[model samples]
Target: MQKEVLIHVRGLQMMDAQGDQEPIEIIVPGQYYFRNGSHYLRYEELLDETAEPTINYIKVSGTGLEVSKKGLVNVHMVFEQGKKNMTYYTTPYGTLQMGISATNLELTESEENLQIKADYALDMNEEHVADCYLAIQVQPRDCKDFVL
Candidate 1:
């Protein structure tokens, strides 16, 4: 069964070369479900101020995780600790060769809530772009005490 959920995402990107940091935070309505052993969170990219909202699917499992989205930014990314995955990022302007190497993946789940933290290195066009950290917190729609 699928349950309605509220998702809060906070991301930080630090450029390895320039040491510039970019931070983004957003809270969106989403759905949470489980299939087999994998947990799935489906949401839309509404706060990006885009003409069309991108549908995002985040699948988490024991081995790794996959994030796929279509619309404003189209990309399918895989993060498995200690392994690098190559992919292409598509935008309205053009496509760029993207690589992601996951350094850490931590997940916690309980009856109360679910939390995930991931750290990785990001590269674009074979050049190091940034070191990234992503944290996601999911809770039932009724839960209001959790803060970003």
Candidate 2:
């Protein structure tokens, strides 16, 4: 796929069991860049032969670009499952963080000549996060590869 089509997502999830709330799942869509500043991302549905509870879609649009993503999101598949972790990314309620198992990430935009690299960890912290890291690079798709 091209480098200008991506919708990144990261946040916490809550589940209700026995009339109580608990942290049973997480959504870590990795980090991305558009270079154009802001963009849009939207998703309606998706399919994954493996993961049963596959993610429907992920959309993002800001000031520069737009994109849609679909697939299964397993924190355990991407994270190391930390110790009773509780994280947040939206609203004015609580903090947001997640357990990640990303070994290494490298994204290089051959067009824009940009790149980024990141590491993985069992635990992370996001006391006050908003998760507004969606950028866009519209049309003609002109950019380079980037590393996570």
Candidate 3:
């Protein structure tokens, strides 16, 4: 992918015991780069009109994926297949302990695009909350074939 890109992120969270919820989707312009055998993506996410946008940084490598967010919210999350990672998630309302246990992680890359799909379980405050799926697709900004 090029340095200037468009990113489409689709996420689904299903209550472990309750059921599935509607999926959330977002498309935004972003910056992408490759360094030291890792891919990096930077983007700003607007939580709402009244709130400041959150800046997100994602790092992807062979072993795992890391996401760090700043601004309106702050968090650093790690995902590695078959491993449970814990971290603190801070938001305007308050902070909570968060955990991610990834069951599957797939990464596909090409000269013009990149795709990532992950399936995991989520825990909040040390209790199992949900099972989640995340898919991220990135293409060069100038690519005419790119679509949400």
Candidate 4:
């Protein structure tokens, strides 16, 4: 892949108590690079007209993946197969203790694209909130297979 890329992200949150929720999907332009044996993807997300855009960073390593966001909300989350990670999530509304217990983590990469899928359970304030699935696809901006 090239430095300029298109990222397609799909996220599903299935509430343990309430059942399924709508999946969130987004396709955006992003920057991709490799450093220190890790692949990094960076993008900006505009939450609304008034607030500044949020910066998102994803780091993919051999062992796991880490996602960090800064702006209106700040968070640093880690995902590793069979491991539970905890962090404080700060948002405009308030802060909460968040936990991510990843059940599965898969990655597929080729000359043209990179794909990641993660299945995990999410917890907030020590209570089970939901089971989540996240899929991320990254490809060169000029790739012919790119789609919305």
| Candidate 2 local Cα displacement, residue 119, angstroms | 0.8
The global C-alpha lDDT for each of the candidates, from Candidate 1 onward, is 0.89, 0.30, 0.92, 0.92
Model 3 residue 52 CA deviation (Å) reads: 1.8
lDDT tens digits by residue: candidate 1, 31-59: 99988999899999963674689999999
- For candidate 3, the C-alpha RMSD (Å) to the true structure equals 1.2
**Residue 13 displacement in candidate 3 (angstroms):** 0.1
lDDT by residue for model 3 (18-106), tens: 68686999889999999999999999999878988899998999998888999888999999999999999998899999999999999
lDDT per residue for candidate 2 within 11-113, as digits (tens), equals 2222223333222222222333343442222322233354443433222222111122233432222211122323332212443355434344433444433
Candidates 2 and 4 compared by TM-score, better number: 4
TM-score of 3: 0.96
User: Which residue window of length 10 is worst by lDDT in model 2?
Assistant: 128-137
Candidate 4 residues lying further than 4 Å off, grouped into runs, are none
Q: Judge candidate 3 at residue 19 and give its lDDT.
A: 83
- Candidate 3 worst ten-residue window by lDDT: 14-23
Could you estimate the TM-score for every candidate? 0.94, 0.24, 0.96, 0.96
lDDT of 3 at 129: 92
lDDT of 4 by residue, 13-100 (tens): 9987668686999899999998998889999998778999999999999989999999999999999999999999999999999999
Better of 2 and 3 by TM-score: 3
